[model samples]
Target chain A: MAAARARSEERRAAIVRAALEVIAERGYRGASLGAVAERVGLTQQGLLHYFPTKEALLIAVLEERDQWDTGGGAREGWRLDLLGSLVEYNAMRPGIVQTFSALLGESVTEDHPAREFFTRRYAQVRAEMAAVLRAEYGDRLPGGLTPEQAAPLVAAVMDGLQYQWLLDPDAVDMPAAFRDFLRLLGAR
Target chain B: MAAARARSEERRAAIVRAALEVIAERGYRGASLGAVAERVGLTQQGLLHYFPTKEALLIAVLEERDQWDTGGGAREGWRLDLLGSLVEYNAMRPGIVQTFSALLGESVTEDHPAREFFTRRYAQVRAEMAAVLRAEYGDRLPGGLTPEQAAPLVAAVMDGLQYQWLLDPDAVDMPAAFRDFLRLLGAR
Candidate 1:
């Protein structure tokens, strides 16, 4: 029974992987369960049995991707230099980054399934950034803005660099630009 | 004959307006010509007279929005303060900004119809930003980076702030955040 359950988990992981690939090629609106099923040599019914719904599968894919990036949880008091490393790491994985960016852009619409997820995620991220800033710089940053004020700028640069780098990789060096932002914050 | 031509032009503008509404609500992939035509009280066949294809209509809507933002022409040597004004102005029109953001996000997908438009647009925008930075700061800015090095960061902040603002408007003061970025650049 344990072996059977393990097999099921493996199948579920494969479905999420295929879904990411499909979403990378087609935007979330264009990605369909049948394409994901076919990619994994499973029927639509088989995919549904594991995910129950397309939205569920999308959530799983998002969670899985985040796990890969965050190591299954948020890092408390993550420093600016660590974020610079993550940005550099992201540059090596264009497909995953593209999929994540596309979903992020789509989530801004009123009814997108991922809307709440991204909205909540940013709130948490801003908080985490604030903690990091406070840990490093105390009450106020070198720019005279409080940690709360600087948090959004940190989040914005991370996301904004992804958009520009994805659009033109050669032109926008994501990590270097991020380091520049760090310098602006007076971080060493 | 002049009156007939003017009426035709009005019809084209109406179609573009309807298209923006549909795209904003349903995203580009989910939107259909039928829905846009229905919104403007025109049959799909009639709409085709104004825009031969959906892609053409999409392009028209984007161009129209650009016209509105650019004031029907590009600014020559636009200053940093002017960009701050543009960001502030964008906050006032949520619908237009949402549609543009949705399309910009979707354009990252390889075969998306807006891909080429965005790619070319960014190339132009980055050059314009470099020009603006050079005009304002000359060869080396206070941050010790060249205008060319700084242009992408400027573009990134403008777009990055949009994503953060779109996600959580109450938490992010988009214009003020932009002002913070300008301060980082040491722009007066």
Candidate 2:
């Protein structure tokens, strides 16, 4: 039974990979399940074996993205780690970044799978990073700036930098810009 | 003849405004020309008289957005005026910001009309903003940064910040973040 479950998990992961590829190539509405299945050498029914609905699959894709972005590779405090990961991420899969941005745009509907996924994801990341801020700079919260305030800027700058990179990757020294952000926060 | 021309322009503007509204509520594919026509109280063909293709219409919408965002208000330097305009824009119609972010996510192809539009827009903004940077600092670039680097970062930061704002408007203090960016740039 364990072997069967492991196999199922692998299949789901494979399907999810294919979905990302398709979504990246074609925007959300542009990519269909059949195309995704074709990319994965599976039938539509087989794809459904993992994600019973499109919404479920959208959630999976977002969850997968969150994992891939962070990837359990936090070597230090959440801020630097997150920024470092973003720099690495932009270099690794520019396509995924575009896909992410596109998903965000399309996922604004209140009940869209991505809406809930992103809301939850941000809540968690904000809290986690905020905790790290507390641990490191609990007494000095940037002129008593709450973690709530700092968390959003950290996430926002990372996202904003990616958009800038997409337009002209060579021009933007993302890490340096991030350091500048830190300096400004410290100044405040 | 001028009367007719003025009326025609109004129709076009009306259509573009309607398009922005619908596209904001619904994704691009969801916002059909028919729906835009309906919103503007024009027949589909009447709308097409101004924009023969959906792509043309979208481009018009983007141009309208550019005007509205910048206010085409005749500023001495676009960079300074526009940075301040971000606040006005967020307040003007939150939907436009959302749609712009949505479009960025959808910008997977460098060749898509929207992509081309964004590229041109970015280039124009970069050049103008870079000129602002040059004027703010001496002829010598700051931090070994060229106009090329500064231009891209400026665009990227704004784009990135928009995504964050769309996700949670309260996530980042837009103006304060811009100030942080400037301090980092030492542009202030």
Best by TM-score: 1
TM-scores of all predicted structures = 0.85, 0.76
RMSD in angstroms, candidate 2? 4.5
What lDDT tens digits, residue by residue, belong to model 1 across residues A68-142? 777777856466688889989888877767767887888787778887888888888888888888998899777
- What are the runs in model 1 whose C-alpha is more than 4 Å off? A1-11, A17-32, A38-41, A53-55, B1-11, B17-32, B35-41, B53-55
Candidate 1 vs. true structure, TM-score = 0.85
Regions of model 2 farther than 4 Å from truth: A1-7, A18-32, A52-59, A68-82, A109-111, A131-148, A167-188, B1-7, B18-32, B52-55, B73-82, B137-151, B170-188
Docking class of 1: acceptable
Best by lDDT: 1
Error of 1 at B72 (Å): 2.8
For model 2 chain A, give the 10-residue run with minimal summed lDDT.
Answer: A73-82
Distance from true location, Cα of B133 in model 2, Å? 3.6
